[model samples]
Target: MIKTAILVDGAFYRKRAYTLFGDISPAERAKELSAYCHRHIKDEKEGACLYRVFYYDCPPMNKQVYHPLLKRAINLGQSEDYVWANDFFKELKHQRKFALRLGRLAEEQAHFNIKPDVMKKILSGVKTIDELEEKDFSLSVTQKGVDMRIGVDISSLSFKKQVDRIILISGDSDFVPAAKNARREGIDFILDPMRSPIRDDLYEHIDGIRTKAPKLEKQNVT
Candidate 1:
Protein backbone atom coordinates (compact mmCIF):
# COMPACT_ATOMS: atom_id res chain seq x y z
CA MET A 1 0.00 0.00 0.00
CA ILE A 2 1.21 3.46 -0.88
CA LYS A 3 1.74 5.77 2.07
CA THR A 4 -0.26 9.00 1.70
CA ALA A 5 -0.17 12.15 3.80
CA ILE A 6 -3.01 14.65 3.64
CA LEU A 7 -2.34 18.29 4.44
CA VAL A 8 -5.32 20.52 5.06
CA ASP A 9 -5.53 24.28 5.17
CA GLY A 10 -7.87 24.71 8.10
CA ALA A 11 -9.29 28.14 7.25
CA PHE A 12 -9.89 27.15 3.64
CA TYR A 13 -11.52 23.85 4.61
CA ARG A 14 -13.80 25.46 7.20
CA LYS A 15 -15.01 28.09 4.74
CA ARG A 16 -15.60 25.50 2.05
CA ALA A 17 -17.35 23.15 4.49
CA TYR A 18 -19.63 25.89 5.74
CA THR A 19 -20.57 26.72 2.16
CA LEU A 20 -20.96 23.14 0.92
CA PHE A 21 -22.10 21.14 3.97
CA GLY A 22 -23.77 23.81 6.13
CA ASP A 23 -23.05 24.85 9.69
CA ILE A 24 -22.32 21.72 11.70
CA SER A 25 -21.25 21.22 15.30
CA PRO A 26 -17.56 20.99 16.13
CA ALA A 27 -17.58 17.22 16.64
CA GLU A 28 -19.55 16.67 13.45
CA ARG A 29 -17.15 18.86 11.51
CA ALA A 30 -14.18 16.90 12.80
CA LYS A 31 -15.82 13.66 11.75
CA GLU A 32 -16.66 15.12 8.38
CA LEU A 33 -13.03 16.13 7.87
CA SER A 34 -11.78 12.66 8.74
CA ALA A 35 -14.28 11.09 6.37
CA TYR A 36 -13.19 13.43 3.60
CA CYS A 37 -9.54 12.45 4.04
CA HIS A 38 -10.39 8.76 4.16
CA ARG A 39 -12.02 9.01 0.75
CA HIS A 40 -8.63 9.77 -0.79
CA ILE A 41 -7.18 6.68 0.84
CA LYS A 42 -9.94 4.56 -0.64
CA ASP A 43 -9.67 6.04 -4.14
CA GLU A 44 -5.92 5.81 -4.58
CA LYS A 45 -4.51 3.34 -7.11
CA GLU A 46 -2.84 0.14 -5.80
CA GLY A 47 -4.32 0.96 -2.40
CA ALA A 48 -3.12 3.73 -0.14
CA CYS A 49 -2.49 3.58 3.59
CA LEU A 50 -2.94 6.62 5.79
CA TYR A 51 0.26 8.28 6.95
CA ARG A 52 -1.18 11.31 8.74
CA VAL A 53 -3.53 14.25 8.31
CA PHE A 54 -1.82 17.58 9.02
CA TYR A 55 -4.30 20.38 9.71
CA TYR A 56 -2.80 23.89 9.75
CA ASP A 57 -4.57 26.85 11.32
CA CYS A 58 -4.17 29.72 13.72
CA PRO A 59 -5.78 29.78 17.14
CA PRO A 60 -8.66 32.19 17.52
CA MET A 61 -7.87 35.57 18.93
CA ASN A 62 -8.67 35.76 22.63
CA LYS A 63 -8.14 39.41 23.33
CA GLN A 64 -10.39 42.41 23.84
CA VAL A 65 -10.67 44.71 20.86
CA TYR A 66 -12.41 48.03 20.63
CA HIS A 67 -15.35 48.10 18.25
CA PRO A 68 -15.52 51.48 16.63
CA LEU A 69 -19.19 51.15 15.77
CA LEU A 70 -20.22 49.70 19.14
CA LYS A 71 -18.14 52.28 21.01
CA ARG A 72 -16.97 49.57 23.39
CA ALA A 73 -14.39 46.85 23.76
CA ILE A 74 -15.52 43.33 23.06
CA ASN A 75 -14.04 40.37 24.87
CA LEU A 76 -13.19 37.93 22.09
CA GLY A 77 -12.46 35.21 24.63
CA GLN A 78 -16.12 35.36 25.65
CA SER A 79 -17.39 35.24 22.09
CA GLU A 80 -19.06 32.29 20.40
CA ASP A 81 -16.27 32.06 17.81
CA TYR A 82 -13.60 31.52 20.43
CA VAL A 83 -15.65 28.83 22.15
CA TRP A 84 -16.34 27.08 18.88
CA ALA A 85 -12.70 27.11 17.82
CA ASN A 86 -11.54 25.65 21.10
CA ASP A 87 -14.19 22.96 20.91
CA PHE A 88 -13.26 22.12 17.33
CA PHE A 89 -9.59 21.78 18.23
CA LYS A 90 -10.43 19.50 21.13
CA GLU A 91 -12.52 17.27 18.92
CA LEU A 92 -9.86 17.17 16.19
CA LYS A 93 -7.36 15.83 18.72
CA HIS A 94 -9.37 12.61 18.99
CA GLN A 95 -9.29 11.83 15.27
CA ARG A 96 -7.11 8.87 14.29
CA LYS A 97 -3.84 9.69 12.49
CA PHE A 98 -4.55 13.42 12.65
CA ALA A 99 -1.98 16.07 13.55
CA LEU A 100 -3.02 19.62 14.38
CA ARG A 101 -0.40 22.25 13.57
CA LEU A 102 -1.35 25.65 14.89
CA GLY A 103 0.12 29.05 14.14
CA ARG A 104 -0.43 32.32 16.01
CA LEU A 105 -2.65 35.22 15.10
CA ALA A 106 -0.93 38.57 14.73
CA GLU A 107 -3.00 40.23 17.41
CA GLU A 108 -1.03 43.48 17.41
CA GLN A 109 -1.71 43.98 13.72
CA ALA A 110 -5.38 43.04 13.96
CA HIS A 111 -7.96 45.60 12.96
CA PHE A 112 -11.53 45.92 11.78
CA ASN A 113 -12.71 46.31 8.22
CA ILE A 114 -16.06 46.82 6.59
CA LYS A 115 -17.56 43.63 5.22
CA PRO A 116 -17.05 43.22 1.47
CA ASP A 117 -20.75 43.29 0.63
CA VAL A 118 -21.35 46.22 2.94
CA MET A 119 -18.47 48.13 1.37
CA LYS A 120 -19.81 47.40 -2.11
CA LYS A 121 -23.26 48.63 -1.07
CA ILE A 122 -21.79 51.80 0.36
CA LEU A 123 -19.76 52.39 -2.79
CA SER A 124 -22.81 51.86 -5.02
CA GLY A 125 -24.97 54.26 -2.97
CA VAL A 126 -27.22 51.41 -1.84
CA LYS A 127 -26.19 52.18 1.73
CA THR A 128 -24.78 55.24 3.36
CA ILE A 129 -21.62 55.31 5.45
CA ASP A 130 -23.54 56.85 8.32
CA GLU A 131 -25.88 53.86 8.38
CA LEU A 132 -23.10 51.41 9.11
CA GLU A 133 -23.51 49.24 12.21
CA GLU A 134 -21.37 46.83 14.16
CA LYS A 135 -22.57 43.94 12.04
CA ASP A 136 -21.31 45.68 8.93
CA PHE A 137 -17.75 45.36 10.13
CA SER A 138 -15.60 42.32 10.80
CA LEU A 139 -12.44 41.89 12.75
CA SER A 140 -9.58 41.32 10.31
CA VAL A 141 -6.52 39.46 11.52
CA THR A 142 -3.48 37.88 9.82
CA GLN A 143 -2.19 34.39 10.47
CA LYS A 144 1.53 33.92 10.94
CA GLY A 145 3.73 30.82 10.40
CA VAL A 146 1.09 28.59 8.77
CA ASP A 147 2.69 28.52 5.32
CA MET A 148 6.19 28.12 6.72
CA ARG A 149 5.10 25.22 8.87
CA ILE A 150 3.41 23.54 5.91
CA GLY A 151 6.51 23.95 3.76
CA VAL A 152 8.72 22.55 6.48
CA ASP A 153 6.48 19.52 6.95
CA ILE A 154 6.33 18.86 3.22
CA SER A 155 10.11 19.05 2.88
CA SER A 156 10.58 16.79 5.87
CA LEU A 157 8.13 14.19 4.54
CA SER A 158 9.77 14.25 1.12
CA PHE A 159 13.43 14.18 2.22
CA LYS A 160 12.83 11.47 4.78
CA LYS A 161 10.86 9.32 2.28
CA GLN A 162 8.05 9.22 4.81
CA VAL A 163 5.18 9.23 2.31
CA ASP A 164 4.80 8.20 -1.32
CA ARG A 165 2.06 10.74 -1.99
CA ILE A 166 1.26 14.19 -0.59
CA ILE A 167 -2.27 15.52 -0.89
CA LEU A 168 -2.70 19.23 -0.21
CA ILE A 169 -6.24 20.38 0.62
CA SER A 170 -5.93 24.05 -0.14
CA GLY A 171 -6.61 26.50 -2.99
CA ASP A 172 -3.67 28.74 -2.21
CA SER A 173 -1.01 28.95 -4.91
CA ASP A 174 1.57 29.84 -2.30
CA PHE A 175 2.19 26.10 -1.95
CA VAL A 176 3.55 25.80 -5.46
CA PRO A 177 7.13 26.09 -4.31
CA ALA A 178 6.80 23.32 -1.75
CA ALA A 179 4.93 21.14 -4.22
CA LYS A 180 7.68 21.58 -6.79
CA ASN A 181 10.35 20.63 -4.26
CA ALA A 182 8.40 17.56 -3.14
CA ARG A 183 7.91 16.36 -6.72
CA ARG A 184 11.63 16.73 -7.39
CA GLU A 185 12.21 14.47 -4.40
CA GLY A 186 9.95 11.78 -6.01
CA ILE A 187 6.75 12.47 -4.06
CA ASP A 188 3.49 12.43 -5.97
CA PHE A 189 1.94 15.82 -5.18
CA ILE A 190 -1.83 15.98 -5.53
CA LEU A 191 -3.92 19.09 -5.06
CA ASP A 192 -7.43 18.93 -3.63
CA PRO A 193 -9.15 22.26 -4.03
CA MET A 194 -12.53 20.85 -2.96
CA ARG A 195 -13.90 21.53 -6.45
CA SER A 196 -12.90 25.16 -6.30
CA PRO A 197 -11.53 26.67 -9.51
CA ILE A 198 -7.75 26.81 -9.74
CA ARG A 199 -5.36 28.68 -12.00
CA ASP A 200 -3.95 27.10 -15.14
CA ASP A 201 -0.40 27.55 -13.86
CA LEU A 202 -1.11 25.19 -10.95
CA TYR A 203 -1.43 22.23 -13.30
CA GLU A 204 2.29 22.02 -13.85
CA HIS A 205 3.20 21.65 -10.18
CA ILE A 206 0.79 18.89 -9.19
CA ASP A 207 0.56 15.29 -10.37
CA GLY A 208 -3.26 15.33 -10.25
CA ILE A 209 -6.37 17.05 -8.88
CA ARG A 210 -9.04 15.34 -6.85
CA THR A 211 -11.96 16.26 -4.58
CA LYS A 212 -14.08 13.56 -2.99
CA ALA A 213 -16.71 15.79 -1.38
CA PRO A 214 -19.94 16.33 -3.25
CA LYS A 215 -21.34 19.82 -3.60
CA LEU A 216 -24.56 20.66 -1.79
CA GLU A 217 -27.68 21.47 -3.80
CA LYS A 218 -29.07 23.94 -1.33
CA GLN A 219 -26.50 25.65 0.83
CA ASN A 220 -27.36 26.53 4.38
CA VAL A 221 -27.74 30.19 5.25
CA THR A 222 -25.49 30.77 8.25
Candidate 2:
Protein backbone atom coordinates (compact mmCIF):
# COMPACT_ATOMS: atom_id res chain seq x y z
CA MET A 1 0.00 0.00 0.00
CA ILE A 2 1.24 3.49 -0.88
CA LYS A 3 1.28 5.99 1.97
CA THR A 4 -0.52 9.01 0.51
CA ALA A 5 -1.15 12.64 1.38
CA ILE A 6 -3.92 14.58 -0.36
CA LEU A 7 -3.35 18.32 -0.59
CA VAL A 8 -6.36 19.98 -2.24
CA ASP A 9 -6.36 23.55 -3.45
CA GLY A 10 -9.28 25.29 -1.74
CA ALA A 11 -10.05 27.73 -4.58
CA PHE A 12 -10.07 24.93 -7.12
CA TYR A 13 -12.00 22.43 -5.00
CA ARG A 14 -14.67 24.79 -3.62
CA LYS A 15 -15.75 25.96 -7.07
CA ARG A 16 -15.64 22.50 -8.68
CA ALA A 17 -17.18 20.70 -5.70
CA TYR A 18 -20.04 23.21 -5.70
CA THR A 19 -20.63 22.41 -9.37
CA LEU A 20 -20.73 18.69 -8.48
CA PHE A 21 -22.61 18.68 -5.14
CA GLY A 22 -24.20 22.17 -5.03
CA ASP A 23 -23.36 22.47 -1.36
CA ILE A 24 -20.34 23.63 0.72
CA SER A 25 -20.45 21.42 3.77
CA PRO A 26 -16.79 20.29 4.09
CA ALA A 27 -17.70 17.31 6.27
CA GLU A 28 -20.16 16.01 3.67
CA ARG A 29 -17.67 16.78 0.92
CA ALA A 30 -14.84 14.94 2.70
CA LYS A 31 -16.56 11.56 2.30
CA GLU A 32 -16.94 12.11 -1.45
CA LEU A 33 -13.32 13.21 -1.62
CA SER A 34 -11.93 10.21 0.28
CA ALA A 35 -13.82 7.77 -1.94
CA TYR A 36 -12.74 9.64 -5.06
CA CYS A 37 -9.06 9.37 -4.10
CA HIS A 38 -9.32 5.66 -3.34
CA ARG A 39 -10.49 4.86 -6.87
CA HIS A 40 -7.77 6.74 -8.84
CA ILE A 41 -4.71 5.82 -6.81
CA LYS A 42 -2.25 3.74 -8.86
CA ASP A 43 -1.28 1.09 -6.28
CA GLU A 44 -4.68 0.30 -4.78
CA LYS A 45 -3.99 -3.46 -5.06
CA GLU A 46 -1.33 -2.93 -2.43
CA GLY A 47 -3.78 -0.91 -0.30
CA ALA A 48 -3.29 2.79 0.59
CA CYS A 49 -2.87 4.87 3.66
CA LEU A 50 -4.69 8.21 3.30
CA TYR A 51 -2.56 10.36 5.58
CA ARG A 52 -4.91 13.34 5.63
CA VAL A 53 -6.76 15.77 3.38
CA PHE A 54 -5.76 19.43 3.35
CA TYR A 55 -8.02 22.00 1.63
CA TYR A 56 -6.95 25.59 0.90
CA ASP A 57 -9.03 28.59 -0.33
CA CYS A 58 -9.89 32.20 0.42
CA PRO A 59 -13.01 33.89 1.85
CA PRO A 60 -15.62 36.06 0.10
CA MET A 61 -15.94 39.81 0.65
CA ASN A 62 -19.54 40.84 0.04
CA LYS A 63 -22.21 39.13 2.10
CA GLN A 64 -25.03 40.21 -0.24
CA VAL A 65 -23.21 38.67 -3.19
CA TYR A 66 -23.80 35.14 -1.83
CA HIS A 67 -26.44 33.31 0.20
CA PRO A 68 -26.78 35.06 3.57
CA LEU A 69 -25.69 32.17 5.78
CA LEU A 70 -22.95 31.10 3.38
CA LYS A 71 -21.70 34.70 3.25
CA ARG A 72 -21.44 34.89 7.02
CA ALA A 73 -19.53 31.62 7.15
CA ILE A 74 -17.19 32.20 4.22
CA ASN A 75 -16.24 35.85 4.52
CA LEU A 76 -12.94 36.90 6.16
CA GLY A 77 -12.12 40.12 7.99
CA GLN A 78 -9.90 41.27 5.10
CA SER A 79 -13.01 41.25 2.92
CA GLU A 80 -14.09 44.55 4.49
CA ASP A 81 -10.84 46.17 3.37
CA TYR A 82 -11.20 44.79 -0.14
CA VAL A 83 -14.84 45.93 -0.28
CA TRP A 84 -13.78 49.43 0.74
CA ALA A 85 -11.07 49.47 -1.92
CA ASN A 86 -13.62 48.43 -4.55
CA ASP A 87 -15.97 51.22 -3.51
CA PHE A 88 -13.15 53.76 -3.78
CA PHE A 89 -12.26 52.47 -7.22
CA LYS A 90 -15.84 52.96 -8.37
CA GLU A 91 -15.86 56.50 -6.99
CA LEU A 92 -12.67 57.26 -8.87
CA LYS A 93 -14.14 55.93 -12.09
CA HIS A 94 -17.11 58.29 -11.72
CA GLN A 95 -14.84 61.29 -11.07
CA ARG A 96 -13.19 60.68 -14.47
CA LYS A 97 -10.08 62.83 -13.91
CA PHE A 98 -6.64 62.88 -15.67
CA ALA A 99 -6.09 63.89 -19.34
CA LEU A 100 -8.96 61.65 -20.47
CA ARG A 101 -12.02 63.64 -21.60
CA LEU A 102 -14.27 60.67 -22.38
CA GLY A 103 -16.71 61.40 -19.57
CA ARG A 104 -16.61 65.16 -20.30
CA LEU A 105 -17.27 64.58 -24.01
CA ALA A 106 -20.20 62.34 -23.12
CA GLU A 107 -21.49 65.05 -20.79
CA GLU A 108 -21.28 67.74 -23.55
CA GLN A 109 -23.41 65.71 -25.93
CA ALA A 110 -27.19 66.12 -25.84
CA HIS A 111 -27.41 62.38 -25.14
CA PHE A 112 -25.87 62.83 -21.68
CA ASN A 113 -26.35 65.34 -18.80
CA ILE A 114 -28.07 65.76 -15.43
CA LYS A 115 -31.36 67.54 -15.87
CA PRO A 116 -34.58 67.03 -13.86
CA ASP A 117 -36.53 66.34 -17.07
CA VAL A 118 -33.87 63.74 -18.11
CA MET A 119 -34.12 61.96 -14.76
CA LYS A 120 -36.56 59.52 -16.31
CA LYS A 121 -34.00 58.34 -18.87
CA ILE A 122 -31.09 58.42 -16.36
CA LEU A 123 -32.89 56.67 -13.53
CA SER A 124 -34.73 54.28 -15.82
CA GLY A 125 -31.59 52.41 -16.92
CA VAL A 126 -28.44 54.20 -15.85
CA LYS A 127 -26.40 53.19 -12.80
CA THR A 128 -23.76 55.20 -10.91
CA ILE A 129 -20.88 54.33 -8.58
CA ASP A 130 -22.84 54.96 -5.39
CA GLU A 131 -26.00 53.43 -6.83
CA LEU A 132 -24.39 50.09 -7.75
CA GLU A 133 -25.21 47.07 -5.60
CA GLU A 134 -23.42 43.76 -5.16
CA LYS A 135 -23.79 43.08 -8.91
CA ASP A 136 -21.25 45.79 -9.77
CA PHE A 137 -18.31 43.75 -8.43
CA SER A 138 -14.99 44.69 -10.07
CA LEU A 139 -12.57 42.72 -7.96
CA SER A 140 -11.58 39.18 -8.98
CA VAL A 141 -11.01 38.31 -5.35
CA THR A 142 -10.40 35.11 -3.40
CA GLN A 143 -9.38 34.58 0.24
CA LYS A 144 -5.69 35.07 -0.77
CA GLY A 145 -4.56 33.12 2.30
CA VAL A 146 -4.87 29.63 0.86
CA ASP A 147 -1.64 29.65 -1.15
CA MET A 148 0.59 30.56 1.77
CA ARG A 149 -1.19 28.06 3.96
CA ILE A 150 -0.69 25.30 1.39
CA GLY A 151 2.98 26.13 0.91
CA VAL A 152 3.73 26.10 4.62
CA ASP A 153 1.97 22.82 5.22
CA ILE A 154 3.46 21.08 2.19
CA SER A 155 6.97 21.99 3.32
CA SER A 156 6.24 20.78 6.80
CA LEU A 157 4.80 17.49 5.61
CA SER A 158 7.74 16.82 3.30
CA PHE A 159 10.32 17.77 5.89
CA LYS A 160 8.69 15.42 8.33
CA LYS A 161 8.62 12.57 5.75
CA GLN A 162 4.92 12.20 6.41
CA VAL A 163 3.93 10.30 3.27
CA ASP A 164 5.47 8.23 0.46
CA ARG A 165 3.08 9.73 -2.14
CA ILE A 166 1.46 13.18 -2.54
CA ILE A 167 -1.47 14.23 -4.70
CA LEU A 168 -1.97 17.90 -5.47
CA ILE A 169 -5.32 19.16 -6.77
CA SER A 170 -4.54 22.32 -8.74
CA GLY A 171 -4.14 23.65 -12.26
CA ASP A 172 -2.24 26.74 -11.19
CA SER A 173 1.34 26.55 -12.46
CA ASP A 174 2.49 28.14 -9.22
CA PHE A 175 3.02 24.77 -7.53
CA VAL A 176 5.56 23.48 -10.06
CA PRO A 177 8.68 24.22 -8.02
CA ALA A 178 7.28 22.67 -4.87
CA ALA A 179 6.18 19.54 -6.72
CA LYS A 180 9.66 19.17 -8.21
CA ASN A 181 11.27 19.55 -4.82
CA ALA A 182 8.94 16.93 -3.38
CA ARG A 183 10.06 14.41 -6.01
CA ARG A 184 13.74 15.04 -5.24
CA GLU A 185 13.00 14.01 -1.66
CA GLY A 186 11.54 10.62 -2.76
CA ILE A 187 7.81 11.46 -2.57
CA ASP A 188 5.76 10.36 -5.58
CA PHE A 189 4.11 13.53 -6.97
CA ILE A 190 0.74 13.30 -8.68
CA LEU A 191 -1.33 16.10 -10.15
CA ASP A 192 -5.15 16.09 -10.13
CA PRO A 193 -6.54 18.79 -12.41
CA MET A 194 -10.31 19.33 -12.07
CA ARG A 195 -11.01 20.93 -15.48
CA SER A 196 -8.33 23.65 -15.40
CA PRO A 197 -5.67 22.55 -17.88
CA ILE A 198 -2.38 21.38 -16.43
CA ARG A 199 0.85 22.98 -17.63
CA ASP A 200 2.86 20.88 -20.11
CA ASP A 201 6.02 21.15 -18.01
CA LEU A 202 4.11 19.94 -14.95
CA TYR A 203 2.74 16.98 -16.93
CA GLU A 204 6.29 15.98 -17.87
CA HIS A 205 7.63 15.90 -14.31
CA ILE A 206 4.83 14.37 -12.22
CA ASP A 207 4.51 10.60 -11.69
CA GLY A 208 0.90 10.68 -12.90
CA ILE A 209 -2.09 13.00 -13.45
CA ARG A 210 -5.83 12.59 -12.74
CA THR A 211 -8.50 14.44 -14.73
CA LYS A 212 -11.74 12.45 -14.37
CA ALA A 213 -13.69 12.44 -11.14
CA PRO A 214 -13.63 9.03 -9.44
CA LYS A 215 -16.70 6.74 -9.40
CA LEU A 216 -19.38 9.05 -7.96
CA GLU A 217 -22.24 6.60 -8.63
CA LYS A 218 -20.73 4.10 -6.19
CA GLN A 219 -20.91 6.65 -3.38
CA ASN A 220 -23.79 9.09 -2.69
CA VAL A 221 -23.52 12.33 -0.77
CA THR A 222 -24.74 11.89 2.80
Single out the weakest 10-residue window by summed lDDT for candidate 1: 213-222
Candidate 1: misplaced stretches above 4 Å? 216-222
Predicted candidate 1 versus true structure: per-residue lDDT over 53-157, tens digit per residue: 999999999999888888888899999999999999999999999999999999998878899999999999999989998889999999899999999999999
Highest-TM-score candidate: 1
**Once superposed on the true structure, which residue ranges of model 2 sit more than 4 Å away at CA?**
21-27, 38-43, 62-139, 211-222
Write down the lDDT that model 2 would get.
Answer: 0.56
TM-score of 2: 0.56
- lDDT for each candidate structure: 0.93, 0.56
Worst 10 residues of 2 by lDDT: 98-107
TM-score against native, each model:
0.95, 0.56
Q: Global lDDT for candidate 1?
A: 0.93
Clashes of 2: 3
lDDT of 2 by residue, 20-72 (tens): 56763444455555555556555466777777666554333433233231233
